[model samples]
Target chain A: AQSVTQLDSQVPVFEEAPVELRCNYSSSVSVYLFWYVQYPNQGLQLLLKYLSGSTLVKGINGFEAEFNKSQTSFHLRKPSVHISDTAEYFCAVSKGNTGFQKLVFGTGTRLLVSP
Target chain B: DAGITQSPRHKVTETGTPVTLRCHQTENHRYMYWYRQDPGHGLRLIHYSYGVKDTDKGEVSDGYSVSRSKTEDFLLTLESATSSQTSVYFCAINTAQGREETQYFGPGTRLLVL
Candidate 1:
């Protein structure tokens, strides 16, 4: 069984400021991690994913996340944010080895970028 | 961009009514999923289909049923609508290319149960 925890329900940051959204997961086996973003009144869009190899992965809209195995965390970050970047971010995990792709998602973190 | 579209983008109904949401895809992907999004709870899978006529329940499948008679179409039906079931329903398709697997979502259907 795998579960995801996103502690921050809402994060507020000024424009051009750096922001980080924390995500932690618990799993008995290796898993695949993913970050998705959803704008108002829209479905989720894939931001990035960590399957293997590099711990640091870059995604669209100048977003990146680091997969820290030791801490069981996959935190998303952006050096600078824009007002347009305000959206809801979700962290998900699925069993790596299992053929089935069932995603367990976190509650989500709402990012508010104000100028 | 996965050529997925959901029918009746928004709907409203009263309790005890039967509602069915349709998901149509042109990608011909083998896997399709139904998920509901609500305030604070994120998205919860209602059901999924690996292929035509092959469907399985997900974490929150108690009040919903799904059907897939053709590769391009997947339908999710609510037997009896309730206020608790009103939510934003999304349809997604899973595509696996070599070692890469991704799920593309549709615009979503907003259902308001009165």
Candidate 2:
């Protein structure tokens, strides 16, 4: 079985300030990690994914995450955030060998950006 | 944006009534999935289909039944709707091109059981 944990339920930041949302996972086998963003009253959209590549993976909207295998962490980061960036972010993991993709997602972290 | 659409984007029904949600895809993807989203539990898989008439249960399949009669259509049904079953439902398709696999989602259907 695989599971994901997002420690922060909510993160508050001022406009133009940097932000980081923490995520950790537990899996018996190797895993693939992903970040998704959901705006109010909308479906989730993929931010980025860490398949089998360099630790650092860059995503749209100038967001990035680093995959730390030893630590079992894939934290999303942004140099600066805008009010429009306020949304719920989710971290998901899938077993690499499953053949079919079955995603297990974290509770979610609400990013609240203010002026 | 994988050409996925869920019917009855918003539905309201009473408890004990039966409800069926439809998920349609324009592409002939072999794999399709259904999920439910709540406040604390990000999203939980309800059911999935690998091919026409080939369906499997997911983590939260206790109160849900699914059927896939065609490659582009999947249906999820609640035999008896309950208040606890009220949540946002999403449909996804696995677009696996070679080794790159990603699930594209539908806009979602919000169900309210009173």
Candidate 3:
């Protein structure tokens, strides 16, 4: 079984400021980690994913995340944010094997970017 | 959403009514999934289909049923709508590509159960 936990429920940051959204997971088997973003009244869009080999992965919109296996964490970060960056972010996990592609997601963190 | 379309983008219904939401995909992916999103709960899988006529339950499948008679269409049915079932419904598709189990989602259906 796999589960994801996003530490923050909401994060408010000024424009051009750096921000980080923390995520942690628990799984008995090797898993694939992903980050998705959802704008108001829309479905989730894949921001990035970590399958193997790379601990630091860069994603769209100048965002990036580091997969720390020792800490069981995959924290999303952006050096600078814009007002348009305000959205709900979700962290998800799935088994690394060839099993069913069932993704377990976190509760989500709402990012608020103000000018 | 990548070629995925969920019908009746928004719906309002009363209790005891039967509602079915349709999801269509032109990508011809082999896997389709139904998930409901709510505040503080993220997305919970309702049901999923691997192929036509092959459906299985998910974590939150008690009040939902799913059917897939054709490769391009997957339907999620609520036998009896309830206030507790009011949430944003999203449909997703997964291809058999590589070891990466990436899923593309639809625009979503906002279902308000009164």
For candidate 3, lDDT tens digit of each residue in A1-115? 7899998999999999999999999998888999999999999999999988879999999999999998999999999999999999999998843446899999999999999
C-alpha RMSD over true interface residues, each candidate: 1.9, 1.8, 1.6
Docking class of 3: medium
| Model 2 per-residue lDDT at A40 | 94
Clashes of 2: 0
**Per-candidate alpha-carbon RMSD to the true structure:** 1.1, 1.1, 1.2
Task: Say what the RMSD of model 3 is.
Answer: 1.2
Q: Lowest-scoring 10 consecutive residues by lDDT in candidate 1 chain A?
A: A94-103
Candidate 1 C-alpha lDDT tens digits along A1-115: 8899999999999999999999999999999999999999998999999999999999999999999999999999999999999999999998852345899899999999999
* Model 3 residue B109 distance off true place after TM-score fit, in angstroms: 0.4
The sequence of per-residue lDDT tens digits that candidate 2 reaches over residues A13-104 is: 99999999999999999999999999999988999999996999999999999999999999999999999999999999998523468999
Lowest lDDT block of 10, candidate 2 chain A: A94-103
The model with the greater TM-score, 1 or 3, is 1
Question: What is the TM-score of candidate 1?
Answer: 0.98
Best by lDDT: 2
Encode model 3's per-residue lDDT on B1-114: one tens digit a residue: 479999999999999999999999997888889999999999999999989999999999998999999999999999999999999999999855575568889999999999
